[model samples]
Target: MSSGIMKRRPLKAADDKVHDFLTTGIGRVKALIRGSVKGFAKEHRPRSKNGRTAKAIFAEAQSPTDEDGNEIMIQVKKLSKIYGRRPEEALALLREGKDKGEVQSMTSNNVGLYDVSFDIRKGEMFVLMGLSGSGKSTLERCMNRLIEPTSGQVFIDGLDFTSLNDEDLRIARREKMSMVFQNFGLLPHRNVKDNVAYGLEIQGIPESERLERAVASIELVGLAGYGDRMPSDLSGGMKQRVGLARALATDPDILFMDEAFSALDPLIRGDMQDELIRIQSELGKTVIFVTHDLDEALKLGDRIALMKDGRIVQIGTAEEILQNPADEYVDRFVKEVDRSKILTANLFMRKPKNILYETQGPRTALRMMDNCDRDDMLVIDGEKRLIGMARSDGILRAMNAGDRDISGIVSDVPSVRPDTPMSEVVQIMVTTDFPIPVADDDGILLGMISPSAAAETLRNGGGE
Candidate 1:
């Protein structure tokens, strides 16, 4: 009887606390608290007619586009989530120049997110990164409507997700997106095949079709022969692979992975990260990955959103973030990161100033190299495609021999792609000659990476 009373006592105290806050106005208190609970519960409940109608949240603003002009897949605009009985008061305080800590201290309200806005491009691997309490997970949940936002909008491929009716949202989740959680959420009693096919089963897919899709997904994740094994029989990494296969089985356009590989051992985690990169490259799926590890984010993200105190402090590629940190906080956050791995050849490469045409005479090549004060000049063909290097000695020899064109004097030189890592570039520079040519797939000379430029970039921890 006493234990029962003890458990009920906490509930009674909670009611009393609500009653005390009711002095502010019973209707307002009830509405705010009830709405918060209902909104959260509505995420998992069946279709409800009470869900809000869609609105044109981005009608006044332009939708963001990628560098390749790819359409935006996910756009979050001024999204916020405040958890408290007096959320309105907390929100008011937040808007009046108060930080999350200050607002929480004043009103005892936890501000999970505040004014978060960003656009994720289609087929981009976008990362949300921060410390434990920085609200990265909260932001991800808000984007997917797992946790209802206090205010603002989320647009999925131009469709407003926030205003979606329960049935529409559920259907959208089923068809347009899927999530991979940190902890493997496999059903304990189900075999690997059944677990992978769970999403298809939910959609009432034919049993044979779902099983076929599940087997393909399993094979894709490198778990081909483990279909009959239960979740309990799999190792941790294998379990994670099963989880990934399950998410991929549905073939969702957008994959929301929240700290998905944080649980595995270091070696296994690295393998999973590599596998994810390969898979993403092959599938070209838009991934919104959440992580606290800066290295992991730097390695995987096409662009990263760094959050602090429930707000995005910065958003950029790894090189951009490392080279040009937005603020002191961001600077500190990336201070210890290995720049060699993050910096690329394209970032530090210089324009090819002493370029010689392959059709030009040896004298012309020599003159150009002299003008640029360079020992060697990069020779290009008629189409501006890189041919090779023309050293001063080679040009001089060719001129002495009365050669009509510098093409014969041009020698094959080691070259690297623009996206090559700085570490590999440095190694090439060490083993080969200075002023390595940076070229594209078609051998078009994009730029040059000089030894001095590489040295300075490494020393200063940035690029030109």
Candidate 2:
């Protein structure tokens, strides 16, 4: 009877504590809302879907061509571009090696591209990247039936251009696709306006319409005043701009760029890459951009098709290919990309859950929180979407909110998703003045994954 009495007393005492916690915690949260909402609304009124007020916040990049406007899709079918002495014998030896489980050999000279295949979806920035002599350039040229392949099919906009007659191929190039070379290939005799207008000229466009299109293209390339200047009078970067303008002037559905910025200095190269991305965002054409630079590929490629020995070793989104490379060669190509620039918010959005912030008094919430080891306590409304975050440590601050220095006790923190690439997590963790909320597909709270946690996740490929 005595032991039963003692147990009953402790249980009764604990019940009273929990009861106080609930009532007081709710009061404190109500107080926080009362204090912050008005001030927050006054200072930084919440943005709407298109950056307006009184609604949600959602925005997307600008694209000039709608889904129907750009339609020249490219698909490479078992592409092989081999050029060297005794190609047939070399191929035979390679086949023999494969049969003998020795797929690589020392005495091989036919290195451009060997039996590669992949597709460039319409209105996608399909980047082909590899080291020098990886046949990236050759493979790109072969797509538009520019370079004659040794023994593979080149399909453009669903037509097998490799098997097409010269007249048909010429018509296709003129009407459907345009090429940009490493050298500007501008006519020295003509000014920038004429150089840009040359493609339309070849296609029998009237000079009046061609010049108008040329001027627009020159402005598009950011070479407005230089339309009257000759190619020799321009710098290397400017000359490349001239080349890009020429390609754009043709108004072809597909654009093939071959090492177009490799000749410029590093700063100029970066600028050109930015310009290309901005233009690509605006034009939304099916771009097959060839380059040996991995960083450049990451910056521009919607889907990076990493090529090796003339074959597409891997094909995926920049994140997919970088995070889960198909093999050793592809892995090495994307090992050093600075990932923060490409991280998107949707990647961190987690599945929705039934978590709600209990509006409790500071002391009560702090005492309750002290009994656990959770990184954070999510505060949600009736909808269960993220409203705010309450840190485990923040409970203590909220409790001591009376202290003048603890004015900013409750603040905003970010959260992330389970499958989010760690790169985005790191950016939010480093840049934002808060912790990240890790969630699932439906905006459900899945606990917090910190920057350190994210880095470790990447080191182990989201395992362990």
Candidate 3:
């Protein structure tokens, strides 16, 4: 009884901590409701049933087009999958305007996925997210034909995937794509090195080359010294590392991860998520990750596809989803996500109205500021490089002292890259003046972000 009580006490204390944390977070979110609600009310526009799909809405803004060499890695057109009855019969019932449950009841066919279509570009971290039984897993399986799609076309690099024969499909899976599961899927009989090498062995790679690749993959997943470790000797996180190492050993262009970090304890899961992000940054491999955790989706996904009842309800970048939810369902789903972490400067920056060139005089700087109804102006060089800032009083003082150029009065200003998250930007805003310069890597001024704008974005969720 004492032992049981000890365990229960710790668990109970942990639960209390979590409850307190959530309560504080909720309070902060509620405090922003007045501003966010007003912003949402102003920006919100109702959509028709035939509105453009998520891909179309975010195409030019979020995902790059073909002109940028972002070729479609995975394309699904009118894809549908059914279980129980023949596909044709199931498809017939679907076309007759019958719903999934209705078709299942009438024809004894379960509609796993229905009319799903999207194109994943190369080098993108595309996430499929939904609650359980929402067809998120089924859609992922159909992508690689692990579960053969009943109908509709799937194209990889413009090659039709659904039309491939068994042997061709096998080869494609071996060379083009690799899958990681929630379960570690390691072989108990094989050591870590041998398990990772399993894929290369199946491809008939020579022993010397396979071992070399296996060791490289093992190191890639941060398990370099554990090559000889048995699966039974490893923790849940370590076993998953072995699984990831195996997937990487194949050196496939695409990775399909089905709830890959879902099984770990929270701390371990966070570590793995960071590891995957670092790996993705270094390798830039196309990845399709499936998760029911919205926070994970927001953190890892370049673009997210939210599924409901086998239909894709919406698709967008994290900011897009938070700012413009497709419906009440999506709005509720994003309510708890910490917006400060996900919203970045790229989405919230405003155009700078008052700017002075290096060659311009202090009088010119003061004139520009006045015309824009401001006290200060950002100054840039002839090459469009951001130098600093010049306030009206500083410029006038310099002018009175016989200074000809605005450079004489320019003061160092706080600046942020276009990709800086609002979490950092918030701190900078409090210390700096309004309209912090948003510059590029080369120090070129692109735009500015004001305190009100930043607060509005946080309060309103995300917007202009």
Give the alpha-carbon lDDT of every model.
Answer: 0.87, 0.70, 0.84
Worst 10 residues of 2 by lDDT: 53-62
Q: Is candidate 1 or candidate 3 better by lDDT?
A: 1
lDDT of 2 by residue, 1-464 (tens): 99999989999999999999988999799969967764554333222223331111111212233255654367677776656665566556655644112323444545456667766678788888887777788888777767788777866656566886665566567656788888867889999999999888766666667889999999999999898888999999999999999999988888999988888899999999999999999998888888888878888898887877656678888789878999987766565443443443344344433233545555555554556545455565444555566665766766665533222344555666665666657666667644477755776665655455555546655331
Per-residue lDDT for 248-271 in model 1, tens only? 998988899999999999899999
Tens-place lDDT digits, model 3, residues 1-464: 99999989999999999999999899789859955775555432222234432233223333234656777788888999888857689789888988888887888888899999998989899999988889999999999998988888887777777887766676677777898999988888999999999888877676667889999999999998999889999999999989988998998889999999999898999999999999999998999999999989989999999998788999999889888999877887776444544778877788876688978987777777778899978889998899998888898898899887878778898899987877678778888767888999999989888888788766865431
Better of 1 and 2 by TM-score: 1
Residue 31, model 2: Cα distance from true site in angstroms: 80
> How many clashes in each candidate?
0, 30, 1
Q: TM-score order of candidates, best first?
A: 1, 3, 2
lDDT, residue 315, candidate 2 = 82
Winner on lDDT between 2 and 3 is 3
Better of 2 and 3 by TM-score: 3
Report residue 265 deviation for candidate 1 (angstroms).
Answer: 0.9
